[model samples]
Target: MLDLTTHWAGILSVIIFLSAYVLVVFEEVTHLRKSKPVMLAAGLIWMLIGIAYTVAGHGHETREFAAHIIEEYGELFLFLLVAITYVNTLEERRGFQVLRAKLVGLGLGYRGLFVLTGALAFVLSGILDNLTTALVMGTVILALGSESKRFVTLGCISVVVASNAGGAFTPFGDITTLMVWQKGKLEFLDFFAIFLPSLVNWLVPAGIMYFAVPQGRPTPQHERVRAKPGTLGVAVLFALTIVTAVSFKNFLHLPPALGMMLGLGYLQIWAYFLKRNGARRSDEDMVLDSFSQIQRVEWDTLLFFFGIIFAVGGLGVMGYLALASELLYADLGPTYANIIVGALSAVVDNIPLMFAVLTMDPDMSHGQWLLITLTCGVGGSMLSIGSAAGVALMGQAKDGYTFLSHLRWTWAIGLGYVAAVGTHLLVNAATF
Candidate 1:
């Protein structure tokens, strides 16, 4: 007899996952619906479904799965909230404005501007995150966009590519990479093994864009803005936020949420002091305003993530993930599987995919695991909507970074992706 009950549960989970993803993508491509409400709705729906399944079937395992997700991913949620809040607050303090003025003040021609912006975006993405780096750099491109739309478009694309490339080299640079790291699926230094290839990924696309840029005369420098009075304090707090976040994650062995909670408290205190003193109330208002700016944050993206996580977890619980892993190993072997996984990341969010792979726990060499890391990290740049960096930039530079504009650069990004994956293969082969 057919196992109708098991099959139905699996089908329901898949439907929920696909529906959530479709809704999010629809919102992104068409702007027909609001993302936050959709995501919240998806989360609630999945939570109910998951509960139903637990009651009807494996209650113990389902409860354990929910608990594990809370314990492991809870910190990540806190990290996201704290990190976004901090950046929003700092940007309101004119931190981004100051950076923008400086970039414009360089008075570089199209070529120089492209190079400087690309390089800055890459480096900044490594330290902060590709999403923030892309947004900040996109702002600069928008500010100087009056020079040439082509130049602005090329510059924005280059920054997006560079940000993703640079982010691939560090754990903190991209969320997918961080998830892999947290799972102990890949080590910290193991990432550096693929660093050279990641550089190639950025440079190859940048080089093409360089040739395409028009040979125009340098523009006059824009007037620079003076740093806000509390700019230094903001910067210091930002640095401390990162340090404290890492310490909590690494030293204290606490979830990142704990660290973020503490850091937020510290930031609040600092803001309070600034308010009490003679600091301009306008500055305080700006900071608070930035919090509202977060309303612009993609609610759909986060919701899609939650739905996928639950759906995938459901699949794994049902042994589908295990069967898939076994089939891959038996049919294609590990290298090709890694490539396929990487390519799939361009379409699906890499977080759930990486987690799915981790659950499968394939028997592979360390080098092969590193290859997975490298491929997954860089492969996301294949499309505009593939990575957080791309999405954030699109939102930040909507005028210039439309879907079609990104499509124009897709071929270049593909070359970089290929180069990165190829480099990883070579390094893995050599090391093994």
Candidate 2:
């Protein structure tokens, strides 16, 4: 392959990526879907890579790189597809709506809801990915329809932080942790070592931000919403799916995506049974069809994942990430390097950043591996544009949560970031 360090193809690809990312960062103002520019950039960058490699008489190498990148993307794509489909299936069955009704009926004050939502986000993200956790909690926060923008703003920020911190300690929580786990850098149970630290990461900011939340409950809307038949079964199936995914990775030695797809089949079969029984009796319940549920997923967000993977993969193929790894890990050392990576994750997607680190396959202890996992997983909480959860919430909450709104509380999040790191060092010192 051609040397991309100073090559025209590399230079232009970097420019294209940065330009597209700028548009993505200002998506609220531009009214542009975050996926569009990155998709275009991914294609453009690959085209440049293809051309450069062909000119250098290494065209086949470009094909290999594309194949590898596609495989990586495909695994994540399928895993997320099943996860989103299940979430959608639950929503279609009025699962979230019923839950929302229950929470709203509580008539919790703003401060109470703030803690509740954040706490829920943290716990749920351990089972679901951070993005889904944030969206679920975000729905509840938005449902309040509270005229208080400050409440919405604080609630959204709290959820974002909680989701990221919560996901940091679980293999299935964040893509970064999943990548680390999949790479055999850490074991499944080993992730729990950082659980306390992750909790600290969330609680620090939450405790500090608690005072800012306004008092008084929003007017509770009491809708006697009930989940349809099989809702409980679906939840059970989802739990089984999580088990299947873990079993696939740990025991079967198969890709977790396959297990997720099999879990999707569990939903499909149940859906068929539900349809056979004609379970839906009211207008509130949507037909329980898994395929239709799949259709309801956030395609924009999925496509954004597609764009990010390809764009960053292209950059990795060009050698920038390896160079970065050497600079960060070799010169700066593992601890500081991991910390800086966390901060960078606030700027760049942790998926690609972790992917690059796994690809570089640096020598480090178990503690260091866990440290990077914790940092990358929660680092995105530092900025609104940092993680998928934050970005999705910004769009979901609209004017209530913006880049500037999230930026205003960066110091608190940064403190949480530092606290989490220190806790990890102290708690997991045995691993080192």
Question: lDDT of each structure?
Answer: 0.72, 0.88
Poorly placed runs, candidate 2 (over 4 Å)? 143-148, 215-217, 279-287
Candidate 1, 1-432: lDDT as tens digits: 112225665566556656656766666566755345345544554465466656667555556766666655665666666777777676667778889898888777788888989999888887678888888888777777676888877888888888888887777787777776676666556777778888888898899889898678446767667655666786788778777766776788765567767887777777666666544555544333334535655555555556555556556665677778987865899888888888888887677778788777898888777777777777777787777777777787777677689888889888887887787677657764
Q: Which residue pairs collide in model 2, if any?
A: none
Per-model root-mean-square deviation over C-alphas: 3.6, 2.4
Instruction: Enumerate residue pairs that collide in model 1.
Output: none
TM-score of each: 0.86, 0.92
Query: What is the per-residue lDDT of model 2 for residues 1-432, given as tens digits with 9 covering 90 to 100?
Result: 456968999999999999998998788789999899999999999999999888888888888889987887888889889988888888788887887789888888889999999999999899888988898899889888457899999999999999999999988898788777766789889999999999999999999999999887798677799788889999999999989988998899998889999999999999887776774544334347778888888898889889988998898888887788789899999999999988999998887688878877788999999899999999999999899899889889999999999999999999999999999999889998
Off by over 4 Å in 1: 1-6, 29-57, 279-304, 395-399, 428-432
